[model samples]
Target: MFESIKNLFKKEEVFPCIIFDGKIMKYLDLTQKQIDKLQEENKDWTITKKEEC
Candidate 1:
């Protein structure tokens, strides 16, 4: 199960970081549109980060 979950995450675009609720979350390299959708879904949780190339 852990291997499957790791493989799933490996397939996704690597996110440098994410800032949510005044906290810094690393290792979540999601796209802007994806983050936007997440924010839309959960209005209370805000996410932002300095996009990396």
Candidate 2:
């Protein structure tokens, strides 16, 4: 019960990613503008969001 209570105050990490050949490549805590730039840079790749870390 104490462990669960402690976890409630802890923050979860999130990441954006581009999947290439069914593999996850995570970019943690990147700004929206940065993600846009990366999208422009990698036009051939598909940008997607990971659930959470």
Q: What is the C-alpha lDDT of each candidate?
A: 0.65, 0.62
Go through the candidates in order and give the clash count of each: 3, 0
User: lDDT tens string, model 1, 1-53?
Assistant: 89988887675454555656545454476776777788888787756565532
Q: Per-residue CA lDDT of candidate 2, range 1-53, in tens?
A: 99999999986554665444335555555555666787788776556666532
Scored against the true structure, residue 44 in model 1 reaches a CA lDDT of 73
- Pull out the clashing pairs in model 2: none
Minimum summed lDDT over a 10-residue window in model 1 is located at 18-27
Q: After superposition, how far is residue 35 of candidate 1 from its true place, in Å?
A: 0.9
Instruction: Pull out the clashing pairs in model 1.
Output: 14-29, 15-28, 15-29
RMSD of 1: 6.9
